[model samples]
Target: MTAPHPQAARHVRAVAVQPHWSAQDFVTAAAFRRWMRAQLDMARPHLNENGVNLVVLTELNGLPLVMRGGAWALRLRTFERVALALFLARLPRTLPILLRERVSPVRALQLADIDANTDLYLTTCRDLAREYGVYLCCGSAPTPRYERRSARLCRQPGLLTNQTVLLDPNGDLIGVTDKVHLTPDEEAGGVDLTPGALGDLRVFPTPAGDLGVAISLDAFRADVIGTLAAQGCTVLLQPDANGAPWTAKEGLPPDPANLRDQPEAWLESSWQVTAQRQIPYAVNPMVVGNLLDLTFDGQSAITGPAEEAPAPRSYVLTAPRPGFLALAPWVTSGEPPALREAGRHRAALSGHPMENQYREATLHADLTLPPATRPAPPRTPHEDALHALLRGEARAARPGRWPWVLAALPLALLARPLWRRRRA
Candidate 1:
């Protein structure tokens, strides 16, 4: 395996992909690979110019590919419908895992198809990393740890965790980072994923500098950032998938008088965290579009310390302060009035003609990380307050018991008919 050029050690050209999720993309493993290949193909122009050393994708980018085996489910066209289809289709296989693993049916659904989904995700990423000759952060997925020597799944059942893998240009595994903090939905809201160990956090040394990854909510934690910074990490890669509206009010804005939207909240969590740590550079890639009932939207960005001002570019966000090197263009500022009025009515949102144009974007930037001469500014009152609130929330968070009951209700209802047919 050849090493990346020495120049990439300091100045690295990176691409952050804001992918638009669709069921069609995961109709099959080959279809998923084609979709991924198309993303890199779109970045080929930038890759050809100075050669991109790193490509970052968003959190849960591979989660949808669990539908790879369920082409029938993909055709269902709604998350609930697709999920129901998968649950029924894989029920026989999932039940054994569920009973043995003592996991929720949702988790069993994932585990039932784990080998296929994991293989599809890893193989596609490995092939793409080598083909593109770029260090690929293949985004986060809920998967079990595979044995290093045999590269086989441990099949530990409920031990699935949201993990991100880094691959060198030669398609070899560089390192793996599991998300230390899991969202409420991932933990007890039915996904049943385990929280990663903080001690397992480590940086991957690359030609582009030591790269540290914090999957979505993990990036919002100060301790996670501090851990990476203490380890001499230079580039912070935050792969995110925001489950809420981009322009909606975040939970208890730091400044009550001045409410912050999703973007502002994310900026506080991501860019500001890295900037305060003086981590030179940060890349945030977001997943957009909708899958079934969930709609994800965000503007992906590449940022650096606020002190280093570059020439104004059309793609960069300057008004909120000039730390952004490049920001992906989003079609709408907030939820469309129609969408807001319609609420959780999936049919209305999905049927809207403009919905498909939500814009899956690719943001590229050439970042040069120089040694910080000055100390980072002290945490502001807003930062302190927000951090406290976030930490408090994290501590208070527990897997809700309701989701288990709710998930079981559907399984019982769906299985009754099958049982009746067998009795007949």
Candidate 2:
């Protein structure tokens, strides 16, 4: 097996591997480290054997670790009453985890165990990156960044950001990119997070080329991709654990349940940008096993640039089926093979056209089978409303407030017109 290439101004090989994770996989931080190390160890040989210099994993890959100490809270039915009961029962454990602050049960869950797992996740990935000698976009998490007054002082949550931390081959914390948009569903789902500053947007210099990082839906926006291109990012690395459900009633699937069969917004959006701007894009998706009633699917792929080829090819790996690993082999180029092939422009939300289905790609490695489909439970009204707001079909539905506000608005408009006539 070849060692990861020494950093240089040349093409590098990359592999995107999907790990099928579940709440059961992580019952404790120690156990999670072992499991993750084993998984990465197994992948390392394959990546090195294939001469891969860099690796990209999916978003929220660290989430199951967050479930380590909080699995019992998840076992209860996800209704508010049951969740409240669990919250009350777990307060002793929860309070310290929340940095001894009082917050709602859901926020407590986000603040406590998730933060612990994120720390472990970062430390473990950093070790693996150095050990394996591969540059790693070590996956992402809704990580709560912390601020500590001193070494002796307890750390407090500075901000919660859906952030991807990048590690160089030597396991150095080189840079990070935080997601800019949270779909309304993400907001309603209790992820009150801040977006990254666009002014600080950047691309990392790598042996493979300038690597631009974007998380999930950030790739759906034209400006984001344009910014990366303008920043001299020749290759785009997108880490996504899409929560979109496979079969939403209307519109595309919502996150955490984002299925491979569903329309890919990133595909449409990235295609347009790569066509117009000339950047190759790669996507890595997370696969989850029914955690938080959330289902994640994997569809890792590398899309070629647009121009000069008869038909552009997108190297793709079949999504990992439930309880399986989805592995794909990728080789980086300073410019993609189809760099000169022109890609057609299309709206992000729209479905891909048949003519654009250019699937033939270099068979450098074998693709894996996707997991069996898990049927999604019916979405509640709240979930539906959140999704509707995300699709721009409606504003957030505040049940008790909107009705009175709607009624008062019409009366106020009519009264204003009448008062104007009297004054005249």
Highest-scoring model, TM-score: 1
Cα deviation at 32, candidate 1, in Å, is 0.5
Give the range of the ten consecutive residues with the poorest summed lDDT in model 1: 415-424
Measured by TM-score, how close is model 2 to the native structure?
0.62
- Model 1, which residues run further than 4 Å from truth? 1-9, 48-52, 74-77, 148-153, 252-259, 311-319, 333-351, 370-424
lDDT by residue for model 1 (55-147), tens: 888888777776776776555555556666777676666666666678766676777777667766777888898888988888888867543
Model 2 CA lDDT for position 373: 23
Candidate 2, poorest ten consecutive residues by summed lDDT = 415-424
Best by lDDT: 1
Instruction: Give the Å shift of residue 375 in candidate 2.
Output: 48
Q: Cα lDDT of all candidates, in order?
A: 0.66, 0.49
Q: C-alpha displacement of 100 in model 1, angstroms?
A: 0.8
